[model samples]
Target: MTAPSPARVVAARVLERVVSEGAYADLALDGELDRRGLSARDVALATELVYGTLRWQRYLDWILAPHSRRRLDDLDLGPLVLLRMTAYQIAFLERVPAFAAVNDAVTLAGRARKPGVAGFVNAVLRSFSRRGATEREPRPPADLVEALALRCSFPTWLAARWMARYGASEAEALMRALNERPPLALRANTLRVTRDALAARLATEDDIATLPSRYAAEGLVANHGGSPSAWRAFADGAFAIQDEASMLVAQLLDVRPGDTVGDVCAAPGTKTTHLAQLLDNRGRILAFDPQPARLNLVREAAKRLGVTIVETLDGPAEALAPKFPALCDAVLVDAPCSSLGVLRRNPEVKWRRTLEDIVTNAERQHAIVTAAALMVKPGGRLVYATCSLEPEENEDVARRFLGAHPDFALDPPSEFPVALDADGFLRCRPHQHGTDGFTACRLVRCRR
Candidate 1:
């Protein structure tokens, strides 16, 4: 058996790791990056090849289907992945000459598998290459891939659902925004240091550029030159990596010193620690997550931020709701939803998730919101938020909850970035904010 070329070897191993070990794309890329010891250019090529292929996988398969004599799925994962990479290079990347890209892939496949398999790959690629864009039929007025690429890059079902709720133009805009990469935003821990002070300290480090967040008071967007975590500020806990949109949720909560708060669905606690900063570490925070492993992460995050007020609990919000009985001055129910927003950060979500997830997540979100609502003291505030643009998870849930619990009324978010409807909930779409696809509703409990 012949050994694989460096490119083939890397792609083969990465595909194997992701499929067999269920590893994440970034982790797999990092692991391969270290093992291959690739130069900056090589690393860039590998990264683009891997990530772009994964992002447009469905469309790639659609294009590759006619090229293969056998079924596309019947092909081994390695060659199939390589074909997708080749297709992406041809269609999207102008710098990479199409012939070179296809040839490299064919050579890699041949060496990695067998000469016969190499011929198969080369034949299919050459055949597709000659026919060019002509082989691909004119995109219909509603080609799924074109619709997705232009309108939302979301699965057809998800896009249609968004169109129903947000109308055709907004839905298309929302989906297009999801396909674009999000800017790296971080929230400064005001309890530890000022944003300007942290930014000054970070400026000394080479390859890091800093800017203030347009929306959040203590937010900063960092330009990481190839290394995101290498910034000195990250290690000192002066800042926490969070979206500018997310930081607003904590801001709108308007936590004051000595105010008791409950953060349900708080894990990997971005908002939990942000609440701590707002309260000057003066109030008790009950941070609960359904999964214990995630709760452990919340504890670690709190400790890093030098926060002592947070107490972690592992249980359902419904079960714990009655125990807290109107104890919280503020409650943040950052309910889980179909994360149609922020797909740029996690491209796997585009393929892995389905329209069915919206219903399932909406049910879970409603339960959590209802349970968390119980903890809000009379005259206290409750903020229900999700990193989703879907109305079922945002407006539908908020409307239903307000109807069922007439004691709570929607309170307009003073600090939120997006426009609030007459109902007084903040609605954020990626196209509008250039931030994560987020929606948050702030409610205040009326005194009996």
Candidate 2:
């Protein structure tokens, strides 16, 4: 029996973590890659395998279901994931030959399971390989939403909701856009380097090609390189890897130097550090999140970027709101959301999320925003934001906040109105903005 490719082995192992253990794909893949020490070529292959399999999981299952004797979901996790991994390569990854993919899957299955399991995998794949693309491909359902869901590998319920909200054509465009890889967006740590200077260094020194983001002054989109963390500029805190839309969210706070800011629900402190940068590292930033481990990421980023203004807080925003009532010049509630807006970055989310998760997060978002509202000084801006395309968590949450507290009103004047929807709430869609599907509404507390 031929040996399986180590890259395939690693990809399958990480896929198991993501599927069975609920590990984050990006973090898990990074950890495995560092431990395995795969070459750049195989590393890229493994990375592609991990993400692409997750991205097209629904569609790959559709392809495999008819070929399998047992239900795909009922199958053992190991064989189930290996089958999806192999099927993804055979169908979508053109560079990998079908025979090589099938052989590797068979080898992997044999190593993990009884003899019958290996035979089962080989028979299923050989039959799958012979059937070819068009033969195995299902006819698009008569319902446009169903067709879109199956075609784009989305949950039917999610596709249905999106189609109803965005209409069929635009929803399909959004799905297609999210299925592809997003650009590597980096925020130039203006505390240290100007955007232009950093771009020049990335090219001249690091040999990484780059382009300035059209939306954010401080944002640079790196084309291709090894991870940004490996770059000397990143090590020196010259830039922070943040989405262009997320960069815009922090900028919306418009906090000036020496002003106090509150980052309610802040963790993994990407925006916390951005607020500090915008504040010229002179003002105080009260950052809060429930988990210490996630807060550690914020602290590490702050230290790396030379940001000294951030002050981390413990407990939920509502519990801590009493400590600083009307204390900040600006407050940012980067609310915990379903993260439907960032599917390209976290493709596993499409599988993991349920409709109830959407509803529960929306309710939690409203409570957090209301609590954060109390901490904003009168006339100060309370920026409510989420990486969620869902209205219940986005506009509805903002609107509900306004209903209970008439003292707070929506503020429409923004640096990036192009991302604003017809109703004036900021809506960044992957198809339209080439960024995550972020929705932000800026609310200003009345002076009286």
Clashing residue pairs found in predicted model 2? none
lDDT of 1 by residue, 9-86 (tens): 575567556656777777888888887886666666776676666666667777777788989888887778777778
lDDT for model 1 comes to 0.78
lDDT of 2 by residue, 1-448 (tens): 7778889999999999997899999999999999998887788889899999999998988888888899998999999998999999989888899999999999989888586888889888988888867788767788887788998999999999989988999989999988989899999999999999999999988899999997988999997677778899999999999998999898888889999999987889899999999998998999999887888888888999999989998779989887999999999999999998999999999998999998999899988998998899998998899998898888888888899999999887754635576787887889988998888878899998
TM-score of each: 0.87, 0.97
Deviation of model 1 at 341, angstroms? 1.4
lDDT of 1 at 216: 80
Please, what's the RMSD in Å of model 2? 1.5
